[model samples]
Target: MSVINKMLQDLEQRQPAQVTASNNSKVPAAASRRSPMYIGMVLLLLLVLLVGFWFSKNQQLQAEPANATNPDAAVRAEPRQPAPKQSEQHSTDQAAPAAIIAALDTTNTAANALSESTTASAVAAPAENAAVNLAAIITAEPAKPTEPTAPAPLVVVAAEEAALSAVARPQASVDKQPLSVAARQHNMQLRANASEAAGDTSAAIVIWQQIVALQPAEAEGYLNLARLWLKQQQIVTASQVLLQARQNGVVNAEINMQLAQLAVRQGQWQQALEFLSDQFELAAEPEYFGFKATVLQQLEQHAAALGWYQRLQQLQPEQGRWSLGAAVASEQLGQPLQAHQYYLHAWQYRQALSVSSHNFIQQRLKATEP
Candidate 1:
C-alpha cells in the first residue's frame, strides 16, 4: 500500500468521529437551556417509576405470611374470655321475644355452641381425635349434649270415678214373724202389699178393703192399703180408699207426702199440691224445690217448672246441677236465650265449685246439662 493512501483513510475516520463528539456536546448544551416546565415533567416521570416499583414490592411482602402454618389465621389464638360475674353481665333492655322467636334463637345458639366446641376440641387434641372414632365421640357427647333443656314436667292427673251406692237399714225391716194380734194384722198388710207388687192389684184391694172394714178407726191400715193400690196403678181405687181413711184420723205429714206423690202419679197435680200442704211438718228444705219443679213439669206447666228450678238455683248459687236442670227446662219451653243465660250461670257456678272443692260436681252436671 502507498503511504499516501493509508494516511487519507485514517484522516476520514478521525473526521467522522470528531464530528459525532461535537454533535453530542451541542445536544447537552441545548438541553441545559430547556424550559423549567419540561425539566419538572422529566422529574415527575422518574418519581412515578420509583413509586410503582415500591408499591409492587409492598404487595409481595403483604402476600407473604408471618407464620408458614395456618396462613389464614388473623392473629395468634388468645385465651377465651372468662365467665362474667352476675353483676358484671348486662341485662337486655329489649322486650322479651315472642315464643316462636325465643325458641328458634335458643336452638340456634345451642347448635352454634356445639359446633364451635367440637371444632375447638378437634384442633386442640389431634391425636385424641384420631384415637376416638364415631362410637367414642357419640358416647362422650351424650354426657354433655347441647340439646335444648326439657320443658317442665307435664302436670296431669287421672280423676278416679266416684262410686255411688245406697245401703238400706230400715228399722221396720224384720226377717222373723211372731204369733200375735199385731203380727197378724201386719202380716195381712204385708201380704196385700206383696200382691200389689206382683201385679195382682185386685187381690190386694180385696185384702185391704177387708182390713179397713175390720178396723174402721185404723187410719194407718186404710192409708197403707190406699198407697199399695196407688203403687199398683189403681188411681181411682186409691183415691176412694184414701178419702175413707181421712175420716179415721188426722194422719201425719209423712202419710200426706205419700198421698201427694200418689196424686202426682195419677196426673192429679192440683190434688197433689193440696196433699203436700202439711209436708212442712215432715221435712221443710230447699231440696223440695226439685220435687215441686218435677211435679210442675208433669202437670205440663213448663214455665212454672222453670221458675221453681230457677228459685232453687238462686237460693243455692253453687248448685250447678240444679242450675243446669233449670236451663234445660227453659230450653224445652222454647226459651233459648233464657236457657242460655241460665246455662252460663250454671257454668260460672261450676267454675267456682271446681276451684273450691276437691270433689268437683261439674262433671256430673255436664252429663245432665242442656
Candidate 2:
C-alpha cells in the first residue's frame, strides 16, 4: 500500500487510546472544551503516524554489506531521539551519543536473529563458525613480541629446617630449653660476643634476639635480650623479657630494676613500685630518688613524692629548682604551708642562674605559679 495510507491506518489504530483517556471522568471538563488540547492530540497522532511510515520505509530499504561504503565506517540506520529520561542519562554518560545509538540500533536485528535461531542445525553452524573464525583470525593475524615472564627461582630448603617442620612442634615449655637448643643458642651468643668485639652492636642485637627465640630458657640470653630490647626503646618487650628471665630463676636485682624502669616509663606505677620495693641500693644515686618520686606521684603518693623532692634539694642545693615540682605536688596533696615554703625555695634558686638559665627558671617558675 501507499505510505500515506499506511500512516493513516497506524494513526487510526492509536486514536482509540487517546479517545479512551479523554472519556475518563478524572480528566478535567475544561480539557474537553479546549481546542488546543484537541490540536495537541491530533499533532501527537500525526507524529506517531510519521514514525510508523518511517519504520515501514526503513524495512523496505535495501540492505548491504557493512564494509561496502567506507570500509572503516560501519553503515548504520539513523537513530530516533530517545525518550526524555533515557535521553538525559545518555547525554551525561556519553559523548558522540547519536553515533553510538545508531550503531547499536543497526546491530539490534542481527543480534536478534542470532537469539531467534531455534533449530539445532542453525545453532551449531553459526556458534561454532563464529568462535572458530574469531580464534583463527586472531591466530592468523600476527604474533606480538611481548616481554618474557621470568621463571621464579627455586627455593632450596635446608635438611635441618625440613626435618624440623616434618615433626609436630610442641608448645614451648617455660623454665628450661633442651640442652641441644642451648648449645645452638650458645653458638649465637658467642657469635654476638665476637660481633661486639668487631664493634657491631646492631648485628649483635639481631643475633641475640634470634638466640632468645631459639632457647628462651637461658637466663643470660633473656638478660642480654632484655638489654638489647631496652636499648631499642621497646619498653614493653624488654619488661616481658625480664619477666621471662624471672621464670628462669634470675636473682639479679638489676634485671628487676630495669623491668621496673620500663614499667614506670609506661606509667605502670603499681608494677614499678612493686619491683622497686624488692630493690637494694648499691649506691645513693640521685636518679633513684627522682624515679621514686615519679613513681610515688603517679601512684598518688603525693606526700612521699614531695618528701623525696625535699630530700633531693637538701642533698644537692646546686641542682635546678626541683622545689617547683615539690610545691605543685604538695599543694595538690593539701599541704598549703609546705607548698608556700617550696615555692619560696624555688624563687631563691631562680635568682642564681645566668640569662639562658634565667629563661629556663622563668619557665619553671611559671609552672610553679598558683
Candidate 3:
C-alpha cells in the first residue's frame, strides 16, 4: 500500500511537469506559425504596393508626353543628334532617371527598362528559365535605328547594278563551252548510277534515256536503257528500245544479248531465237546456248534446238541438262533411234537432275526402249 501511494505521487508530479513542458512547446509553435503568416501577409502587401506603384509610374510616364503644353519645350528636350556610339551602353545606363528620359527622347528606352525590370523581378525562377525569359523580352523589344548614316557610294551602287545586270543577262563570255557534250554524258551517267543506287528505278531509266539521246551511237547507253525498261517489266518498251538501237546502227553483242533476254522475258520465243541467231557466234557462252535451246524448243523448232543442245553438250559434256535437252529435241524431231541413244546418255550423266527429273527420264527411257 505504501509503494502504490509513492507511485501515484510520482505520477502526479510527472503530469504537471509534462503539461508545463507541452505548454511551453505549444507557445513557441503557435508564435512561429503566426510569425510566418504575418510575414506572408506583409510580403503580399508589399507585392501589391509594388505592382500599383509600377502601374501608376507607367501611367505617369505615358501621360507626361501627351500633357506637354509646350511643343517647343518637348522639341528642345529631345536630342536632335543620333548617338550611335551610345546604343550598346544605353541598356545599362537606362536605369538612371535622367538617362532614361534622355535616351527615350532619342531612342527606345522604355522597352529596355521594361525588359530589365522583368528580368530583375524573375530572379526567383531557374537560371536557364530566367535567361530564356530575358532573351524573349529583348527579342520582343522594338528595333530602332542607330543613326541616319550616309548613303551608299556611287561606285558601290554601280557595281551592284552591274552585277545584277550580269546575272540578268546570260553569261556568254564566261566560257564558250561551260560543259562539253562528253562532260554532260559523264554527269548523266553519274546521275543514273546514283539513282540506281538509291533504288529509284524510274529516275535511273529517265537518266539512261538522256544518255542515249546524247550519244545515239553509244551502244552501252542504249543497252543500259533497255535493261532499265526490262527491270520495270515494260517488255514492249524494252523491245522498242532494241529496235531503235538497231535502226540507229548501234550494233553490239551485249545489245543483242539484252534483246534476246528481253524477248524471253516477254515469252516471245521467235523474237528471242532471231536475236540469238544474229549474235550466236560472238556470244557462244554455255548460258546463251542453253537459252537459245530453250527458246527454240518453245517455238517447236526442234531441229534448231537440237543443234544448240549439241553445241551445249560439246561445251559441257558432263552436264545432264544438255543431254536431256538433246534427247527431248530428237524425240520431237521424230528420230526415236537417236532419241533413245541421247536418253541413255542423259541417264548416265544425270548428276544435276532433281529427283522429279530423274523419275521423268526413267519413265521416258522405259517408253522408248522398245
Best by TM-score: 3
Best of the two (2, 3) by lDDT? 3
Each prediction's whole-model lDDT (CA): 0.55, 0.59, 0.67
Per-residue CA lDDT of model 3 for 1-370, tens digit only, reads 3423443355456546645865877755553344334334334433543453354345335434533654543343334213552363244323333332233223225545644654564443245344533443343332322564446577788999999988966766654667899999999999999999899999999999888888999988887887888788787888898889989987666777678887777777777778875454623466766877788898888998899898778777888889889999998988877888888888898888888889888988987886
Model 1, 172-198: lDDT tens digits are 345345578677778888988798789
RMSD of each: 36.4, 31.2, 29.8
- For candidate 3, what is the TM-score? 0.45
On a 0 to 100 scale, what is the lDDT of residue 79 in model 1? 13
Give TM-scores for every candidate, taking all chains together and pairing residue i with residue i.
0.32, 0.36, 0.45
Error of 3 at 152 (Å): 28
The order by descending TM-score is: 3, 2, 1
Write down the TM-score for model 2. 0.36
The lDDT ranking, best first, is 3, 2, 1
Off by over 4 Å in 1: 1-181, 193-202, 210-220, 227-233, 252-268, 278-289, 295-321, 328-370
